[model samples]
Target chain A: MNTTTVDREDLRTLVAETLDLDVAEVTDTADFVNELDVDSLMALEVMVVLERRYAVKLDEKRLAEITSLENAHRLLTEALEKKG
Target chain B: MQTTMASGASAEALAVVAMVREVQDHRGPEIPLLLLNCLERLTGAGEADVVIRRPRGRRPTAQLDGRTIYLSVSHSAQMAAATASYRPAGIDIERVREVRNVDGVRAHITGFLPRHADATREPDAHAEVLRAWTRYEATVKALGVGRALVPSEFAGNAEPDITFRGLNLPLNLNTATLHTHRRNQHDSYLLSVAARPTSNVVIHHDSDLGYTPANHERHTS
Candidate 1:
């Protein structure tokens, strides 16, 4: 039931659930660290959850790059493309 | 950024001293007075205007005149600590408490820590996890890479113990010696000081300055 496609909206929904944010709050361009006040622990949570959801591997560099929904969408797309 | 006054302290008195001040004010999100005070001591620019730029999510950095001052800060419960140095540094203070997500904590430790080290061996497991968490955080802050840049592996001289203050051990990482300490009592809070090297850490209580409601000030900007 938790599996999601590589779509940006789906990715946003997954991150919103992991960070306990409403879907509307996770705008595509919003900064997770600055605007949302997401800490390192929460950042790690989002990474682990996303990796599990998409069956893709994300290194720490990629994890740090997930600063915004747009950045996350691009990173996840790249990881998914690599898996294909 | 905020403004405060610091008097009667000479930063030139010692070249290597990193004075860390702990302020017990849970009044608001940002404690400006403590930061300004620490900056004054670190910069030796006593009585001069100190402007600190605290960009959200990164360490609070100070630019006095032309040079950049490196420092790290951590806040929990009613406590906020800031330490400044001529070199890059970071600090973390955690209020010792029970952790709800034990498995999640373990996952974080195992994510980077050595697999051989037993993260959950026995008594006071929560404090060990807290120490592990803070060690990495202080390192990240010291490196000034922000939270998103945690290294894949860390081999600090930290080990698990079977006591209430078991996490109270100084970690000597490859480059920096971070002191993990417990304040006042075993149940108070766990503090890790990477503000200075092992030979230079001198912790000061804001309470020593006759800390009062009127002394500690704050602002939104």
Candidate 2:
């Protein structure tokens, strides 16, 4: 995880946009896989967006742990910290 | 019935393809049924009798007669393909398209460049990138990790540190056998399969799945 903090809303927007859903549909507790129909390929795309936006090399293991919006935000923050 | 390709190092397994003529009506909710339909046709199992198990903390499996069957599936421009064997295997296919994001590649995926400083001289860099991408995806799926794999893992290391279902496994590319198949002279599409070391796989294309609704009905009747 990085030291830089990612705004929860910003992360939600990224997820929503990548998944082609409305931003309002992305909630903190929403499950990306179950609720949004994200398969393995889509998950990879999400990680790419996150890596590009944060400029941080994310641990693939940790990225796989992101099932919900809340977890994604937390993971981004931690990955940024590690980058610094 | 269309094109069929069959070639393998051994007879241990087979990869099969079922043409999906119209995907416009086959998106989202229909994908699972589509896969099952294809599998049923290939395996001679009725759609109701084909058992697909989604075990927690494990790769999904399909079974018949209490025996485990190795399986992997892929979808490309006009095909829904599946591979089955007594040994684990993964397959992937991609329809080549225009490369609009060349700058995106150089910026974000510099890993595509050769280590040599003269990589810019390489022609058709776009197609090469797609080839690498498809191969990487096939490798990951063959490893049973699917999208859990990081793309950069293939960049710096031949052996990737892959963790699946909480188990850290060392993956050695040298030990696995990968076969690449191409369709169309212009390279309009490509297919690749990766399997366990020394395992043999036979691949069948859209025309060879042996799906017969009339024959299946007779068996059930």
Model 1 chain A: ten consecutive residues of lowest lDDT: A1-10
* Candidate 2: CAPRI quality band: incorrect
Q: Model 1 over residues B29-144: C-alpha lDDT tens digits?
A: 35666666677766667635656778976777777787777767776555566776666666666555555444555565643242344332223666556555665776667767
Which candidate leads in lDDT?
1
Candidate 2: tens digits of C-alpha lDDT, residues B188-220: 444455555444343433442332221110111
Residue A41 lDDT (model 2): 39
Highest TM-score against the true fold, candidate = 1
RMSD of each: 10.2, 9.9
* TM-score, cand. 2 vs. native: 0.60
Give TM per candidate: 0.61, 0.60
Q: Estimate, for each residue in A18-60, the C-alpha lDDT of model 2 and write its tens digit.
A: 7678998888888876776554435555776788887887776
Candidate 1 error regions (>4 Å): A1-4, B1-32, B41-44, B47-68, B75-79, B93-105, B111-130, B145-149, B155-190, B204-221
